[model samples]
Target: MTTRAGDRSDGTTVWATPAWRERATAWADDELAAQGVRRTGAVEQPHLRPWSTVLRLPTSAGSVWLKAPGPGLASEVGLYPVLARWAPEHVLVPYAVDAERRWLLLPDGGEVLGRRLTPEAADRWHLALAGYARLQQRVSRAADLLVAAGAPDHRPQRLTALLEEVADDAAAVTVTDEEREVVARARRERGRVEELAGVLADDGTPPTVQHDDLHRDNVFAHGPRVFDWGDAVVAHPYASLLVALRDTAAPYGVGLEDPRVLAARDAYLAPYGGPTAATLRVVEAARTVGILSRTASWLRALAPLPPHEAADVREAPYRWLAMLADGESL
Candidate 1:
């Protein structure tokens, strides 16, 4: 039970600080002694961008990824066990080297899927999405089990609350007239999409688990293995599809209308009960609202400003606000 530098009151260890590193090393040594696992030593890997810190630990069993959670640690921990049970076939299972320490060991077998998603890589994308679809089916089944256990349904409501907060701040944020228009439209569209949740839930459609945060970075594809399961949620099945579409559009340079995009979406949904065209549209709209709200906050905090980048950080909230107000989808 050796403690690390960034060890919180709850005993979760933060791997970023020197004290935590010492503690982590000590804990690893102890765990190895208990489990008969041989340690190779700590290998420093470059940290991933966009926040949080991760390190690669070399061990005799295999390489393990040590991720330090920021504010969302508890939420991620709560979600992982559920995903492990529900989507065991599709996700990488996290081995808890130290639960109290918040030290996670994941098999380092997968390559990032984004790297393989080239225009010529249509088949790979299709395979990836198909696997994703199967994962969603399991998630839906898990959601039902959670509901039966009286777990609070937080997915739909969280997005709704975030949008409302964005709307409240939209009026005060300064932005160009064009960006204002975008924000206004987004606000209105968000309202319309929010209203459809009840309809979607009540229409006798089975709920599937969703990876609410399904960015390209979250997915890794090595040979046939996909990793990272921290953000899985039991909610709308199409949520991941929307994430794929959104991510593919920008950094991946894949357009929404691209044949591969459409094909991948279809392949992902084909095995599960297929969602109607309208349902897909609603999911896409809902996801856009969520993204805009997040982007607004990020822009405000990071200050991605004028003279560089497409739009100013200060303007993002307004643009999203205007888009929502006008009922437009990104």
Candidate 2:
């Protein structure tokens, strides 16, 4: 079961229901007609993304994927052309976009990588990492353009400021005892986090585009196309690995120290240069900062939840903050 409609971090209460279907129907119809598709109905893809609504519309030729950004967010339509200029093959460029309504239509990119990850997993992950590295390098030159297109400024320099702001918000909200504890723990470790953030910023690392959420499912298996640019950022390129390294490792029953995992990480870093112990140090701190930013964003989402829905939403983030702040390795 999914989080109740009222508990969703995104403000929209309309999702996976008739209401959401009705609103998206018009967009689907328009895009289908433009694509010369002679279909009368569309189906909602059974996906659990909390950020947007995706509809799979069948056509005489192929399927068309239509997406509408969730409540109070900018449309990612602008990002396609920017990515195309640098890494066209790695992203699915939309055919038509309605900027005002936060809607876009894209050609179906076939199955997601997660479905077939168990076989040739190493090779697939290496391909993904290498392609992603190229995307980062090319996009670095266009950082300003990407940021204007809705990517957040996720550089390490901004982490502490964002943390403090979220901490204060949590302290002021009085929403739940659980959330307050997360904020309390964050505040307790604020000094150490700030110092590390400074080092990350001072490393003089060439900042590049980061796909903040690069979980396997967001990638296509064969084409190795990347989807879901909603969490894209402009940060040190290695920061991408900090997030991906931890994400891809644990699920496969491998630790960060595992040689196999470290090899793939080396592959990701290969685009920039050979692996070095210094880069490893920055990445170690970056992982914590990334988690801190994510936890703060979650708390922001949790701010509006009612008392009844608060408990279910607050536990994991709270526990993570406590563990990370207390110097426990995740």
Candidate 3:
């Protein structure tokens, strides 16, 4: 039998191994029986990547998903109970979590939002953004709990040091001379990150769970449930918009400044202050410095990836950090 841990000498992830699958299958069977849900068909391994793996189990009730993250991303398993407690309406409470193994068994979260760009899609974006904003507001009070449960804390006050750390790390900034220059500029202007942090703090919106990635596919169509917390961080809530607006608008051939995008932005901002000039300023600042949080998330996930596989993906952290040099491009 294959070993239960460690990648293959050839650099394959362990989750693809029969030994790991056997352990996961046994655990899943026990969990399902406890819930009185019997398996009705063969289990399917639908997603397996360097950072995580997802197994789809057919059962009496319906299909349930089992996700196991690589060690670097294990915190995602511990986060669901906290999210369920704080924003039950917006995210699912996992059926069970194996804290030791970092695995989560979750109910089917319904259809993902459509990828097509349409007026209807914009409406869905508006609701998803607004609903996610509410989730952030609700989850704000659980910051300490979330941190204890392993969510990375990228709170506003910590931005300056985090900025310096990422900008100075050679491993994170190994790309281009232009990116090098951007990193240098970012280091010199580290004070600006501190200033932005102060502005956001004064705005009275407490730092909450920032889904470092919030796009159409991450949210659901049948309801407001948002999944994929592996990249989540506890930071200035508005920081989430950097990814939300950019990714959602890209497929539609629109930018963040588009009318549809602005409406969606306002929808998200409604919970905070509804796009007032001051709020917009705060948001722009958050989205700018939030780039570091994005870089940090990528670095965390990329840490354990095989060097050969991560050569291209490794450029992401530096690329995002370079955005700090470009002012308010969000």
Candidate 4:
């Protein structure tokens, strides 16, 4: 059965339903028990969306988090073991994973980065991105295995094809006439999209695992370990900067050109060769293509939801596509 957020048109609601919660709770308890841990209090549902939901279990050991993803994100269940093996120092390997149920039991990774950028947090940001880049470099060697394990394949060369697929799905992008025009214009710019992808591919930084939604909240403050791999993809490594720099800097009222943002960018690029003009151009191109990668990921997340259930965020993919209509960096 497909798990959706709150769609009960079929006379059933999967997420948050009594039976679903019971099963998830039983599984989480079993997983905890296997590790010699016992729950000390009631489970709490902290986050719920069309794509996934999270449960917080207070335990003898501390707090363990249980994540149950919607049908669209079932791959994330399988990616945890792979990430744990590849970047053990940079991620919390799940305590237990139930791939068939699309659930993961993870230990409470420490505090997350502060919402706003402070002087003290700047170094942590730099360290997080730098460490993440190193992890990407290592993952590049096993890029194929990443895709095999369920990370979306967003390689530079494949971006235009992804765009083409989304564009043809008019139902997915067209909410208004203007949005339709946005899709039409994006389709015509297919060549430009392919050209940018080529630039990124030729830049010599091999495609690797990119946390398409990498930002402050996703990185723990301790190891500064990165988590939340549901939005991950195999893409140009620099493509990650789109979210790391732009999204991270936004809450602080800074743009990518801001010194702090630039510092973090340089930190990540250091492993790839620092921020020379050539590398910066590659960064810009990667950012441009990264918008589509975000779009593709959103499309996947939104695919299995009923129209009403997806209503609030359904415009996301087209909105990202609209950024490309002006041929500007997103």
Candidate 5:
């Protein structure tokens, strides 16, 4: 059975029910016990974007975050180990796994940095991003070995697929002629991104794993542990950077024009770097397409929304669309 948080009608989140949680908890206990730890209690923390449930379990040794993918759990199992092996220098170590329970036990890192997303936080984020860039360089090489060994391609195809699906529904969501025009423009831009993907796929190089969703909540400060590798994929080098740029820009109110966004992007691509401008453009286009598509999908799924909620939903995509339309970098 599905255990839901928030409004079920909205389809934002739902997870395994009491029995499922109990089974998962029992499995977690076993996993932790193997690691010389014991679970004392658990607290729930809800994440909004790509909604999921995080359980904070106190252990005899310390606390660890038990992230159970509401619906995306299997994806986590597939990607986390690969990331653990490839980007060891950049991400948090995954300590234990309960494959049947669809849960991952990560040492509870400290609070997330940039709670407020200020310029100072941006700089620190930039430094952290540089570390990710270095990690990506190593992972890119590792991806080749995995591919030769016959592993699946880990590109951001989900984003690509999501965009195409959303673009088709744009007309229903677009209430005005002007809005329709904007939707048309977005569709055209997405086409460019698709073309770029085809070009990349045709090239001889292997795809690198990317954290398709790289928002602040996924990253931890003090500990510098990047968690939630469920969205990892083997894609073009710039795919991860693009997601990071959009994530960092949104929190800080930094537009695409913000030098820090570009600087961070540059820093990320500096090592084992490919075509900076070209790759960024493709990723940027992809990001826009992804946002547009997701927004459209959410709007469609929750249609005839309550007036207040509908207004909020309607304004969400346009806000980002306006930012992009203004030719801002983010």
Candidate 6:
């Protein structure tokens, strides 16, 4: 059945090639039949979403989504239930979590929201940002439990260390005297940068659920249902804005100056006095350092890079460090 991955069929079955794909599908079929539904069609989304296998299955009853996440993502399984308790409609409600097999049968999440803008798109975009903020606020109240459940800590404790590390890392690379001086200035000015992030959802403030990746495809068009919590972190929620701003701005073909884009920013910042130049700076700083964090994570996942080529592999992230040292906004 696994002739190829992301295969589509009008027939009553869907196949994917996750390590657990076959076992997960058989379990899904058994579970569906127990509910008196029979599978009729299936298709896999072509995109690789972290480490899970996503499938769309048509059944006698309705569409069912199969997500068999890898071991590292067990936290996401529990997060769905947590969201259900926090905000009922905020995320898709999984019908069941086969904890032992590490899969979930969920109601189909609809298409990605607004690939192109419509007049109505602006309103939805605003609402999605506001909704994201509210979700973060709610999760902030439960930060301890979430961290216990394995959400990451990207607060000032982490950021302060990151700044120091970036400075050290950049120094290891060749830099001009001016850039070195700039890095020294950054170290001295680190307190203010920490204060900015700390005042948000970082260490000093209540930690919130920050969705580090919010590309349009990760969000659904119908209810704007957000999926793929694999990279969710309990960090400064402003970090989420970095990804949001880039993805949101791209489709509108306008910079942050545009009214619609500004509205979206305002909506996201409504609880924090709306968007301002200062807030933009915080957003930029958080994501700029985040570039290194993300790079390190990706490298770790693809770990044990040949020692000889390791330095070459690290050049891009070192360059990001150089940018951070120069105080250049990402």
Task: Name the best candidate (by lDDT).
Answer: 4
lDDT of each: 0.54, 0.68, 0.82, 0.82, 0.57, 0.62
Reference-based TM-score of each model: 0.71, 0.83, 0.93, 0.93, 0.67, 0.71
| 1-330: candidate 6 lDDT, tens digit per residue | 011112222111222445345566678888888878788876454433333456667887678887755443455766666666676566787777775655678887766675667767667776777777887888778776677765656665677776666555445443467556655655664675566556454324355777777666777766667787766766777777766776778886777667766676788888766767777666665666565454333333222232342444545444444455566544
Question: For candidate 1, which ten residues in a row score worst on lDDT?
Answer: 1-10
Candidate 2: global Cα-lDDT?
0.68
Superior by TM-score: candidate 4 or candidate 6 = 4
Q: Candidate 5, residues 82-156: lDDT per residue as tens digits?
A: 667877656667777665545677776677765455667776676666666666667777775544432334344
TM-score of 6: 0.71
- Shift in Å, residue 210, candidate 3: 0.6
For residues 1-330, write the lDDT of model 1, one tens digit per residue: 112123334222233467776665666556554666666876674663322456777788877666654332333545556666777666677665444544555557556666454665556666767777776666676785654432224355456665555554554443556765555555566556567555445445466555555655666654333455434444555656646666656655767877656776676667765657765755564455445434433433323222232233445446445544654544
Q: Which parts of model 1 are misplaced by more than 4 Å?
A: 1-15, 48-50, 97-101, 117-120, 144-162, 165-190, 223-226, 229-233, 251-254, 274-329
Residue runs of model 2 more than 4 Å from their true location after superposition: 1-23, 35-41, 48-50, 72-78, 115-119, 172-178, 300-312
Model 6, position 12: C-alpha lDDT score = 15
Clashing pairs in 3: none
* Candidates ranked, most accurate by lDDT first: 4, 3, 2, 6, 5, 1
- lDDT of model 2, residue 150: 62
Look at candidate 3 and tell me the lDDT of residue 230. 91
**Per-residue lDDT of 1-330 in model 4, one digit per residue for the tens?**
233445332121566677787888899999889889999999888887767888899999999999988766677887889888888898888999988778899999989986655777888888888999999988788888889988878898798897887676634546798878888888888888889988988888888888899988899999989998888888999989888888667877877778877888899999887889999999999988888878777777877777877789988888888888777655
Q: Which residue runs of candidate 5 sit more than 4 Å off their true CA positions? A: 1-17, 41-50, 115-120, 141-191, 198-206, 273-330
